[model samples]
Target: MDSLRTCVACRRRAARDELLRVVLSGHRLIPDDRAALPGRGAWVHPTPKCLKQAVSRGVFARALRASGRLDAGPLENRLETLMDN
Candidate 1:
């Protein structure tokens, strides 16, 4: 059975595989496509809407137990690439 994870943006729980995992790397958000990155991770639906909510509401930092601002540009670009494929 798939483990459940809560989306930081939607605040909804779903199967872990159904959401994208994001990890912080030196204040920058990085998409963990393989879910193998070290450190804390924040999950979110792989959609622009969810991404927007996560960024706009500053949920990533809170969810990842990080303080200060986080750059989501890398994550955003990764999501765009994934969506394009």
Candidate 2:
């Protein structure tokens, strides 16, 4: 059986490996590459456009279930780095 997870941005179920896992660490968004981050996790496609949509449209916050500030800088950099790999 394949592991399944929901993409917070798209609100659709996808294979675990098919989506990127994002976590909320207090005031920041962290990419849980190993999916081992403890806490609530959000997910989005491994695309820059999706990242932009999730951040600009407040999808991440909604998925994370918290209302606070968010910083996209490091997350964006991390996504770019992952895309390169």
Deviation in angstroms for 70 in model 1? Answer: 0.8
Q: State which candidate has the highest TM-score.
A: 1
TM-score of 2: 0.88
Report every candidate's CA lDDT: 0.94, 0.83
- State the lDDT of candidate 1 residue by residue for 2-77, as single tens digits: 9999999999999999999999999999999889999889899999999999999999999999999999999999
Residue-pair clash count for candidate 1: 0
User: What residue pairs clash in candidate 2, if any at all?
Assistant: none
Q: For candidate 2, lDDT tens digit of each residue in 1-85?
A: 7788877666778898888888887768888888898998887887887788899898888888978778767788898898899
Candidate 2 local accuracy as lDDT?
A: 0.83
